[model samples]
Structure formats: C-alpha cells, structure tokens
Target: MSVSSRPDGRRNHPLSRPVDVLERRVRIGIVTVAVLGVPLAGAAAGGAAYEHDRAVAEAQRDQWRRTAAVVVSEVTPGMSRGDLAGDGKAGTAQVRWTAPDGRPATGVAPVPPDADPGDRTHIWVDRQGRVATAPLNDTGVWAGSLAVGVLGAATAAVAGVAAVAGVHCLCEHRRDRAWEREWDAVEPEWSRRPHQGG
Candidate 1:
C-alpha cells in the first residue's frame, strides 16, 4: 500500500536488507541453473541413451535378417489381432523364404488376410531361418533418446525450482527473525517505555 525510498539504517547497506539481497542472489542462481542446466542435462542424458540404443540396434542388425517369404498357407488370428498389428501385411501365414546364408527357409510370418499362394511377404529370420521379431531400427533409438532427454530436462527444472523454494523459505525465516529482534529493541524506545531485559 505504501513505498519507502529510504531504507532502514540498521542494515549493512542503506539501500537494502541483507536478507533481501541474499534471497535475490539465491533466486537468480537457481533461475540461472534452471535455464542453463536443462539443456546440459538433456544433452548428457540424450547422448547416453542414444549410445545405448545404437549399440542394441547394431547387435540386432548383426543377428537378424529380413528376407522375402512366399505365402504357403494362412494362420489367421481368430479376433483379427494379427492383421490389426499393421506391418503392412498381417494375419499369420505359413511362408517359405531363403535365409541370408542362401539356405531354403520355411516359417510362419504375417501376411495379408487375402494373401493367396505364392504371395511374397517379407519376414525377419535368424541364422537358423526361424521366424523372429524385426530388428531394432534407428527410429526407435532416436525416439527413446528424445524421451530420456525430455525426462532429464524435467528433472533438472524440478531440482532448480525446489532449490529456489528451499532457499526462499530459509531467507524468509531469517528475515522474519531479524525483523522481530529489531522490533523488540526499537518498539519500547518508540513508545517511550524503558527497555526491559529479555
């Protein structure tokens, strides 16, 4: 409701209270960390995640092979689960294909529901020509890395905010105590009462 240009002279500086200055400095420090730390934390986390995912993808690529398979018979899911999985072609089908080692392979894979005999469908297989899940892809690695990066940034921001709040509360407590002590000493003098020993 009111403003004072002249600060109380009891403080170290005529311009401000010590607690106010300390609180301001703490707030600024926390804000700076939140701003600068988020990106740093995000990058560090993202880099680690990227390395881990890329390593996994490399391992999968080395271990799995994608080859074309000819649909020999259908093994449709009763509830349309297989066709709904959406790898372009779906519905389980008995298929024949060649492995990376040039060995003739026969396995069950997903194919179109209307797939007829001899329809070519791609499948992933191991060295033994057994049906296997598709190898991990670069897209998955990027997605995972990005998610980790976001989580890291969020963590940094929350830490920064918590730090600021803790310091603010501590500074407010100190300010209140200082004000109370100062008022106790000054209140009697202003009221023209003799100071009493506490």
Candidate 2:
C-alpha cells in the first residue's frame, strides 16, 4: 500500500509532543533568566553608583563648608544669582551677587575668619570688601538631577527586561502549539503500527 494509504497516517501522537514542549520551556526559561538578570545587575550597579556620588558630593560640600564663607554683597532687581567656585589661585572668594536694581555682579573678596560658606551663603564679604559669587541654592538642583538620572536609568532597564520576558513568553507559546501539532500527527500511527509484532 502507498504510504498515505497505510493504516498509520502522518498524524503525530500527543505523547510525543512533550519533547517539543519541554524544549520550548527550556528555551523560554533561559531567555527569561537572561532578560531579568541583566537589568537586575544594572539596577544594583546604578544604586552603587548613586551612593558613591552622594558620598562624594557630601564630602565636597562638607569641605566647602569648612574652607569657604557665604557673603551677600548686595541684591539687585532682575539680577540672576548663581554659585561661583573659588578662583583656585587666589585666597580671594568669588561669588555671584545681585544688586537691588536686579543687576548681576561678580564679587571677589579676601576670605574672612568665622565665616561659613554653607550657611547664609547669600552674604559674602571680606575685610577687604564684599564680593559676589553664584548662589548656593543650585546644590539641591544638582542633587535632584543625579537622583532623576539614576531613577530613569533603572526604569529603562526594568522596562527592557519586561519586554524581553514578554517576547520570550510569546515565542514559547507558539512553539508549544507547534510541538502539539507535530505530536498529534505522530501519535495515532503508533498503536496500529506493527511494533516488532508485539
């Protein structure tokens, strides 16, 4: 008889389908592990980096508090205020000052004893004269920026992992279905076929 006319058709058996299902499960598991692992590792690393950055910033701010003083030269209308770093070469303090008229001014003055830059930084004056430096208020902005950056990165990483997992699940489901079909085609022939005449 022709192969098609045989009692056993090409239809697979359900029992044999498990192999394909198992293979798909293994593949999906592997992909899921990889997808989830990478982001978790990145998040851990980001946390560490954030901590390191915070520590460093705190240390720097503390040092600035000890060595520098805040002095408000004068306030001006429409004047933009900002923070100014020490010139590094001069003992003179550099600060951004705003005039009552709202005008911007840069002031440089000799460091004063008993002056703390961390407190009331709006006011900066030296025995020589008052100087203007940028406003110290921007520290909060900088800190916020750092936090936002870390959080954003972490969110992106988690989203990416989720997407990968979703794709893996979809592919596994399709594979499982295909495997079932394959097995269904093979199963019926088994019982009718001559199995060593047993």
Candidate 3:
C-alpha cells in the first residue's frame, strides 16, 4: 500500500488515491495497538483489583467470626411471604448466645429458614460483638476482579474500533474533496466545444 502511494501510482491508478495510503496505515496502527494494548490493560486492571479485594477480604475476615446461636422466635414472625422457602438457608430471627467472655448475649441473627424456637444455627459477629453478615469470600473477590477486567477490555475494544472508523471516514472525505477540487478546475474547459476555442 505504501509503495502505491508514490506519484506514479497516485496520478495513474484508479484505486491508489494519496489519502488511501494514510488511511490504511492509520488503520493498521490502530488495530495493532488495540490488539496489544487492550489485553494488557485488562490484565493490569484485574491484577490490581484482585490485590485490593484480597487485602479487604483479609482484613474483614480478621475482624469477623462465626458462632452458634439459638432461635428464640419463629423465623416467619417478622418476615413476609416466601422469605423462607424451606431451602434451609439463613433467615432473620432473634437469637441467644454466649459472648466470647462467657456472658449471655442475644441479638437478631441469621438462622436456618426452617428453624423453630430452640433450634441452633451458626451466625457471624463483627468485632464489636454485633450480629453481622459474613465477610467477603475468595470467590467474590475473584469474580469482582474478573468482571472489572472484562469490562475494561470490552470498553477499550469499542473505543479502538470507533477510532479506526473515524480515521477512515476522515480519509475518505479528504480524497473525495481533492477529486472534487480537481474536477471543479477542469470542468469549464472540458465542457467547451472545439470550435469555441475551448
């Protein structure tokens, strides 16, 4: 393509417009960068996200703990319809338990959906001894990192394609305007008749 951009081909070849070579080169450069840069950016994003999330997860796990508690009320007394579909997963309830210091303690906790009064269930507690949701697990950290990476790569890919297309459109406009200017300069004389000394 570069070889055909010389004056010989620019003036004689129907397809070798001067603007075409620049457009092709720009397109190739854009594609090359996209191919190499997007994945690199994604990997960098994913790695950074993973490291950040992993640190957060470690800190959260260090400050939370799982313990045994007993349900003191019906799981459905404070819940609406279908909140406990009997899948046996955790459901909100008031519970009784002994704190790490052996003093009796009670708070709202998550227990088995099918739990009744006196049923034991495991629950998590925060550093200050309040019932809390479990901390971030490894799976959640990995999933978040993967999502960030994928979204970053996808957005960059779209931007790259748009840039190449934009360059191509600009080149096409330049070539067409050049042809139009040449035609404008020659149209009058070409339209004149031979007897009119055109």
Candidate whose lDDT is highest: 1
> Which candidate, 1 or 3, would have the higher TM-score against the true structure?
3
Scored by TM-score, the top model is 3
For model 3, residues 56-98, the per-residue Cα lDDT tens digits are: 8788789978888888987854442222222335567888987
lDDT of 2 by residue, 161-187 (tens): 676566567767977787777667666
* Span of 10 residues, lowest total lDDT, candidate 2: 74-83
Better of 1 and 2 by lDDT: 1
TM-score of 3: 0.72
Q: What Cα-based lDDT does every candidate model obtain?
A: 0.78, 0.49, 0.77
Q: Give the better candidate number (1 or 2) by TM-score.
A: 1
Residue 192 of model 1 has an lDDT of: 96
Per-prediction TM-score to the true structure, in the order listed? 0.63, 0.32, 0.72
Per-structure clash totals for the candidates: 0, 39, 0
Residues forming the 10-long window of minimal summed lDDT in candidate 1: 77-86
